[model samples]
Target: MNRRISVAIDGPAGAGKSSISKVVAKQLGYLYIDTGAMYRGITWALLDQEIEISDTAAVKAALDHIELQLVPVEDGLRVLVNNRDVSKEIRTQYVTSHVSQVAAQKAVRTKLVEMQRSMASVGGVILDGRDIGSVVLPDAELKVYLTASVETRGHRRWLELKDKEDITLEEVCRTVADRDTMDMERKESPLICVDDAVVVETDHLSIEETVQKLTELIRNAEKGERHG
Candidate 1:
């Protein structure tokens, strides 16, 4: 039997990291881990417990009691906190606005990285997030830095929200810039591209196109995989 492998896909918001990662994982028969959602789940826990984000010690303590889990489903993945369904809850406007602060916490990143590594130990996984390629899985068989123009990303988010919520294109554009600022300025694990990382520009590509390119990258890498 062939050994499993790890793939890391990193990108800014609305560049289709979540959507592309899911489709790519399904095609490759690999488990997909959304590190962003994991951070959001922890943010949800902080809000539920009325813990303040500024207090680092308090935030770290709160995380000890909250357990985050992911279960694959027909629609996508289901997120659970303490084994309770919170997939939809974490995507709310509230969580969307606050997740960055929660994720910015250094202690929080340490804990989450530990969990992500434990899950990726056996491979057969594709992890997507801002820092996955640079920090979480630097040794992944394949690393992708997926991105699109700020305007394009905003438009995509606008359409999604217009269909399901009340977010405006202008608002999303601002959110995109804000996230980029915070991520780039962050002290711990700022999102950066290392040497030899493949960058995918998705401004004009279809979702299928993005997945197809990534799939080929993996197939090529698997040829060079090491086995005992």
Candidate 2:
């Protein structure tokens, strides 16, 4: 059997990590794991059960019985919690606003990170999240830290949700900024680029361009590994 390679993509919210990672994974015939969705899945459960985000104990206790599963569909992956599909529900503004708090909890991070590691154990996986490169998959074969201007990111996010929600550009920008602060200031596994991670700035690049650039980077890295 051919050895599998693990790719870690990390960045702040709205940096296009998820969308780009999915295309790159598809091109390489690798599994794409959206770690952010896993956290959002937990947030969905907490909201569904009315568990207060401020109550760390309640959140930790709730996680004990919560099960998160990622099922691949024709378009992308669907997140399931306890056999029920909550994929679309988890992406709401309410959930997005509260997910940072849930993700900051040490217990929640520990559980989800373990599951993520297990899923990528055999490699051939592209894991994307705020802390994938720094925390979840530090030893991954290739680590790419993707980033873009906050304004650009906000615009991308707004475009994705303008029809579904009554949000303006200013609101989206503020939300994106707030998320970056929370993600960077969090105590556990805060978002940071590891030393060896190659940084990819996508401020001026199209999605296809970003994916093609990353695919080339991965291919070169694989070649170097084989030649070395």
Best candidate, TM-score: 2
Deviating ranges (above 4 Å) for candidate 2: 1-3, 225-228
Worst 10 residues of 2 by lDDT: 219-228
What TM-score does structure 1 among the candidates reach? 0.94
Clash tally for model 1: 0
Collision count for each candidate, in order: 0, 0
lDDT tens per residue, model 1, 153-214: 98887887777777788988998888887887788888776665788999889998988988
Per-residue lDDT tens digits for candidate 2, residues 91-112, read 8888999999999999999999
Model 1 Cα shift for residue 96 (angstroms): 1.3
Roughly what TM-score does model 2 have, to 2 decimal places? 0.96
